[model samples]
Target: MPYVNIRITREGATSEQKARLIQGATQLLVEVLGKNPQTTVVVIDEVDTDNWGIGGESVTVRRKRGQ
Candidate 1:
């Protein structure tokens, strides 16, 4: 069994993009981990840009700062 957790910023991506991401992730796990698609569990979490940060700066602010 393979468990995948995906965290993404819910800003510009559409529903179709999200679906494709999930499908691709599942496929990768099936191929690389040798997990069965029927038994694999994938979880996608949509996080706000304001709440997600990197290097002590929020993603929204980082984009504005260009760093």
Candidate 2:
């Protein structure tokens, strides 16, 4: 079984879009690595912008600063 973890900012991703991400990840494993889609696990984690940081700044603050 192949497991894939996807993390994204908890902004405005719709349910449909999240579902697509899961499907796309699964499909990529199937097509590229010959993994079985049924046995592949994809987990999507949504982190708050404040909790996610980059370049010594949180995503929330970075967005506010237009970085």
Candidate 3:
């Protein structure tokens, strides 16, 4: 069995986007790892922007810096 974990900011993506991501991720796992889709586990974690950080900064801050 293969486990896939995906984390994203809570308010950014719509339900459809998340669904598509889950579907595509499972397909990718099946293609690359030869894992059975039924046996594979996919976990999506939705967190607030303040709680999600990268490169020692919050996601909101990162986006602001880029903009």
Candidate 4:
């Protein structure tokens, strides 16, 4: 079984978009790694911008500063 975990900031991504992401990731693994799609597990974790950080600053703060 292949497991893939994708984490993105909670920015109002639609269900269709998220489903496409899961499908794409599964396809890539099946094509490149010869993994079985039936046994593949994909999880999407949506995180708050305030909880994600880069360069010692949170994404929420960075967006506010237009960085």
Clashes of 1: 0
Candidate 3's residue-wise lDDT over 1-67, tens digit each? Answer: 7888998788768888888988999999999888899988888899988888988889888878882
Sorted by lDDT (best first), the order is 4, 2, 3, 1
Per-residue lDDT of 29 in model 4: 99
Each candidate structure's TM-score, on Cα atoms with residue i matched to residue i, is: 0.83, 0.96, 0.78, 0.96
Cα deviation of 6 in candidate 2 (Å)? 0.3
The segments of candidate 1 whose C-alpha lies over 4 angstroms from its true place after superposition are none
Steric overlap count per candidate: 0, 0, 0, 0
Best by lDDT: 4
> Residue by residue across 23-46, what tens digits does model 4's lDDT show?
999999999989999999999999
* RMSD in order of candidates: 1.4, 0.6, 1.8, 0.7
Deviation (Å) of 53 in candidate 4: 0.3
For candidate 1, write residues 1-67 as lDDT tens digits: 6888999887778888878877998899888878788877778888998999988889999878775
The C-alpha stretches of model 4 lying farther than 4 A from their native spots are: none
What range of 10 consecutive residues in model 1 has the weakest lDDT sum?
9-18
lDDT of 2 by residue, 1-67 (tens): 8999999999999999999999999999999989999999999999999999998889999999887
